[model samples]
Target: MFDESVSKKIHVPLVLSMFIGLLTILINFFYSVEDIRSEVYSSQSKELRAAYVNGLREKKVIALTNVINLSSNYSIIESLKSQDRNVAIAGLQTLSRKFKEQTIYKNIKVHLHDANLRSFLRTWDVEKYGEELAGFRKTLRDVKKNKKAIATIELGRAGLLVRGIAPIENDGVYLGSVEFMQGFNSIVKNLRKNREYETAFLMKEDYLSVATALSSSPKIKEFVLAVKEKNVDKDFLNSLKGVEIEDTKNFQISDEYFLVSEPIKDFSNVIVGYALIGEKTSMVETVIAKAKSSLLKQVYIIFFIDIIILIYLIIIVRKKIIRPIVDMEKMAQELSL
Candidate 1:
């Protein structure tokens, strides 16, 4: 009798153990599948971001080159080379006004280096920020020396500007420099007008905030400044670290972020800047929420099927196995008694 009771107790536990083991196996399988799905989704998101950034950079370069080519026309250069300041200024104003009207440029300005081709045209605001113009002067000197048709220049507080310097040669003498200024704002506005993504910024080698589409809200400005201070290079490095496409691994700025960056090249295909695109974490979170909702529905359906299968298996075990074992136990008990 004692042996029979012991066997029944062990039998109950063995059945429970088998049920638990089966449940564990199913749970692990589902968990692993979920992990894999998340990983694949993250990777795809990264690739998409990188592609978008590179495309924007390429577009900017093309647009800039076209603008440079237009600015380099001999007629435009000759008008600026005229010895009369009034004629040169009038010509420049007319060209600037016409270019602004026809093209997507904003605040277009022209500078001419003087008859000596040494001192460049000084804007009214130059005196206020004389220190800032030094780098621009240096860049102008370099462009003149190298005779580069298109180039990127850093103009301290004026921000980074794309310049097209076309030398005007009247007779055999080099007359002056015809410098075209396209503010970084134009690029920012262009991107904003065309692209749907938020947080687009252009960064130079020094990580200066050339132009940003960030909101005018103080909070946003503060956040941007914080980002600039903390990880300017780190952020830029993360974007261009890879061979072609660099996707930062779902970094969170304030929330979850999807970011991609690509180097900006000039007409000569030299990297001069970087274009960065960022999507807010909230957007991804919304996607995840929707996915979870769908997943839950699937999970519920699978769970229902699992429950039905478990119930069927339990019924079969009870009828074919447990009942017979119970009958054997009952017979042995009767014999012992």
Candidate 2:
């Protein structure tokens, strides 16, 4: 009977007390875990943004270098001066083929433009020539005006192009400009293959309006345009209903999709679009898995201490209260007899 009394009063309350401690620890640990995850995602986003910038910078350097090489060629310069499209194509046709075989520089478009910004010859589209670019080819005009090599991301009739332009001159007179351009798809898809991150180049409708693109581009948002080779899926695009395309810093598309964005500018330093860099939330989950293991270890330690505390309370109750009550009842009964 006394053992039953001890269990009913002492053991139950002690278990409850132990559980309270455990519950508090679990709550606090979860909050801490959430903080850790936020910090990790923010840090990773910054790193991804840096990687994206470096990729653009590297592409710019290569474009400038190759454009300079093309402009310095006597044959290409002479061909541009003579307006002989055939000779210009023959001079760079082999290099164009080898550029396609590259790991990331495929779809390179070689354009020969006159000083009037008129399309003279295009290696990518040879038959289409004599198109007046005085209206939309701002980068080529910039190279012609500045008389220096230039490279940047620009909107073209073909879509977004990473272009490098160099002035072609003979006898101190500018004949034309030669261009080495790569499409955005080539770069974004390459980033996915190399860095294992999804990316999209979002162009504003206002900016895209100047160039009559050869193909129809999808509308990601009200006025935002996205390339067909986007690594982000339609679900992520659907999530952008009310979100500003430029406000994608630490943006989470879903439970499993997270993205970070940086604004992209053209040759005139105009903000035309955004570059979204993202990875699946599985990346965050991998880091959190380790955190959860540590949290479990802390919980186990606290639970062990709680068990010991519960055992000590049970011993105290039986010795100090139960035994005394039993002896007192026995003495009273004997005296009554």
Candidate 3:
């Protein structure tokens, strides 16, 4: 009976203690993994944003330089200020033909506006975009009002565009502004081909304005294709809504992905859209598995040592304390008899 009681007491407490210790270790290990994952994601996000912004800035600078060079010419300025549509049209055509071979003017769309914000000419084949005033209006206003150059990444009718505007001035007289825009497909193309990562330009409502992924993986290709306007999953949209500039978070579509979103701002500093750069979870999953395995290994070692200690205590107590008391009781009973 004494032995039975000793077994019940020691075994129950030993099992409970082991369970508690294992639970604690598991909790701690998971917390550590989360912290490490967040740190890794954040560090990588900053690097990606910096690279993307640098590329974008370079493109904007090129466009601004071209606009400045073309618009600053005395001939272009005189044509713009002539107040005659025919002269403006003829001069613009001559300038276009003259510089058609220049690499800087290639693939660029130009718009010239007068001082009252009236349209003078556009390189497009249309007769007019109407006097309604289109394109990056704020940038036009800044260039016209301040008589200086301005540039920004803005959402346009066709797609996301990098725009540059500079005042058409001759001898400190501001005739109007010359605005130039180039589609950002080249930027996205460079990112997809040069950097082996997926890139997306998402407007409001999870609309994928443009998306591309590295061709190295067929899975990534499929993933990017499915990430169109209508195919965005609800969970992913909800998760994406909360992402801010330079903030990194985990999201899921076909599978888990870590995404860092940077806001695409206009000249007025408004968040017109977002640029999402992401990597598949498979890469980080491998890291997390290794970390957890290492943590569990430590837990196993500690648990083994604890079990040995518990067993040793049980044996010591039964022999030095419980067994001795029972033996003394028997001796006393025999002497009394």
> Which candidate number maximizes lDDT?
2
lDDT of 2 by residue, 27-132 (tens): 9888988887777777778877887888888888888999999899776887888878778888788776777787455666788898888989888789998999
| lDDT of all predictions | 0.50, 0.76, 0.64
- lDDT by residue for model 1 over 237-321, one digit each (tens)? 2432331232234432333445554555544455545455555556655666666666667666766776677667666766787
Single out the weakest 10-residue window by summed lDDT for candidate 3: 216-225
Q: What is the TM-score of each candidate against the true structure?
A: 0.53, 0.73, 0.57
Pitting candidate 2 against candidate 3, the one with the higher lDDT is 2
Question: Clash pairs of candidate 3?
Answer: none
Clashes of 2: 0
Candidate 3 is scored at a TM of: 0.57
Model 2 alpha-carbon drift over 4 Å, by segment: 1-31, 101-106, 229-243, 295-337
If both were scored by lDDT, which would come out higher, candidate 1 or candidate 2? 2
Output the better candidate (1/2) by TM-score. Answer: 2
Ranking by lDDT, best first? 2, 3, 1
